[model samples]
Target: MRCLLPLLLLLVAASVAKAADFAARFDDLVRTATPRQLYALLYDLPKGGDLHNHAGGSDRPEWMFEILTDPARNGGDAFYTRARFGPETEPAARYRLIRRRTYEQLAPAARAGYVPLADLSPAERIAWANAFRLDAPGEGRDEFFNVIWPRRGDLSQNLDARLELLVVNLQAFAAEGLAYLETQFGLDGLVTPDGRALTPAEAAPLIERRLAQPDVVATGVVVRFQDTVIRFRPDAEARLSEIYAFVAAHRDRWVGINMAGIESDPRGRPLRFLSTLRRLRAQHPTLSLSFHAGEMDGADSHVRDTLLLGASRLGHAVNLIKDPDTLLLLQQQQRVLVEINLISNRLLGYVPDLTQHPFPEYLRTGVPVCLNTDDRGMWDSNLTDEYFTAVTTYRLSWPEVVQLGRNSLARAFVQPEVKAKLLAAYETRIAAFEQKYGAGSPTISDALGKVEKVKPVTYGYAKRTWGLEFR
Candidate 1:
């Protein structure tokens, strides 16, 4: 026993030494690596899952153009952009995509104001992309909330377009080594190119069939949907009840319910849905809730009230620092996981200075926090951008980064069996990454060669910010 004890002690000491050496090496890389190199490393990192994605918001404008312009994939459908010229009465240049009859079908009077998206000249195409993304300097919250969404026109009203978007998002996430994705989507007004509305019940099967396609299946990225109710809408309660029923019926593909909207509006207060959610629980007791709370600039009790709303996951929780009790509940008890969207918060003008973000506070205090792409396409970013922001801004340790992935899978609303499989797979993948990138091992560049490096859409923004250009 004594002999075994001495040997065990030696093994323990060696393990500790190895860990310390890896830490030193990681810290050195963090300090010395160029933004490009660091971005490459992050791109190859195993991000377990994205739990707070919005399907429509993740649509890249370039990709959208490709999807909308291709005749074979409903691209031949006529779409128009609401263009504002100089001397317009709006705050900024605003454009929205509208479904209008074809050039041949429309009367000359009706066709006078609309321009076909397919026939847009190069300059017009650039203008359309700019209008869709939050890529402009002065464009921020209002543009995102008001202009960008409406610009999609009837695009969101088409399930096939949505399926294509989901496929692209999944493919992108898979390329970045994401094991799962929980994106918010609703089939409320989904229609065909000919304007045939499909009910949620009908849309669910089509979505499942599309997801089961060979290409999507080959990616091996598990995906589920959360029906999002626009909280500030007048019929939010009625919409909530309908989504709850839809989610209950489509539990295979739909897992949770999320209320997302401009929270600063008084109508979006957490307490407003308290009784409604309680009643919803009485009927559909198993429904999971991931509430967007505390996304405000000022300190308020919204976070506390959201907890009262019984959300298993809190999206944003930006103002949690102001409420000590709620912070303790989340941190000390680890009662719920906070979905942190660093890029979204910054780009949306909620937390402009990332250093002031409560992500590190929540993480270090033992609150289960995971990185997510809240509106990656809108931000012209993705999961890697979120990690980059968190790691660079907060100087996260390697273990902390790994724990973020673990927390993402841990808090996901996937089935228990699927979650277990995902968690196990994530552990293996991360271990391989650590092993490959450990001290005295190959450099990040060498390790990167073995993995796929997806060129991120936000690279331009990162380059401008870091003063580093890509080849």
Candidate 2:
């Protein structure tokens, strides 16, 4: 008993010392100055490869909205529908979903004629701008996208319009600090406002002919044209064949294919989609699938369903947390990258708020998770804002931010050599900045004091699978 007393004392001392170190590290982080120093640490960070992005206008809202309305594209249909919650939750008198001019819909909902898309009251042209008028609004996912539908009528079947919008946004993205984007743009079966069915094959030609101009492919900016599938389409098999063929024929231009909107999609479509996908793979062999699997609100059944479908990459497979087995699959395979969209979940009422978002938990355990803006313009968010939220809300430090960016780069869809090329350049710059500034600043500041020098950590973080630790 006497001997054990000393041993226990030793153990307690060690625990307390470790706790002190942890507290110190965090306290220093809170005092960080200039979001840019955090940016310098995280800026140009290898975002383990972006896996969550919409096809058109994934850039900025202003970039998306104004470009679409460009006289060159089309002087088109654009309106705003204020989104809202229930009567019990919202004390604003009534719930609504109104169709008003996008410009007029600008005022805050607290003002008159403001319907939160819950229950809307239409406003006239001048009043529309008075109510809600802005070419580029906040970056919430729903707000960004809700505007799209009202304007869809004015932008359909015009391939150049889509490309121009994307191109314009890409430039905006670069200006805003993003290095790359992996989007599933241009849908085939997706209905236009007038209800026209547009396919990848049709949209591909327009983009392809444009890329034929040389500057498109030479930009080194990666653009992945993801051929899409509607979950449980009655004609799933036939459409699957068409996409497989499209990808095969345009392998040079196309990166892969993905299944979209499969979560609540009816038709027992998941099983059928997987069965057809497996058959398609056997036939074509290289038709890669980045399926939107297990975005389940409350179940793990879809995780297994996605694996059965032979998905190489998993988009929004957020619900994988519900099952331990799927967690192992993600760790072992390390191939399926999840597209994390914190802002989207909040606006869409997926998890109530961003804190419940799964990325930090996914990362702590070593899963291949990447940060993406999802649909920034629609959601009224940007990559920077998402990164900021993660660091503050999730209490992520510089190292973890580095880790997330590293994960994004690792899981990126870019080819091996190309990724290596970018990662090398990215790391070199980081190393120089760190060495020039310091190993790690207790806090980043704009005042330009404190950081004497900064040096980069050599090589990137090793890619590994971390099991679920949060649950």
Q: Which number leads on TM-score?
A: 1
Task: Please give the CA lDDT of all the candidate structures.
Answer: 0.80, 0.55
* lDDT of each residue in 186-246, candidate 1, tens digit only: 8888666676778888888888888889999999999999999999888999999899988
**Candidate 2 residue-pair clash tally:** 72
**Residue 147 CA error for candidate 2 (Å)?**
8.4
Candidate 2 lDDT, 365-401, residue by residue in tens: 7677767776655444456556655775787755566
> What's the lDDT for candidate 1?
0.80
Candidate 1: which stretches are off by over 4 Å? 1-21, 83-86, 89-94, 100-107, 439-458, 468-471
**True-structure Cα RMSD, model 2:** 12.4
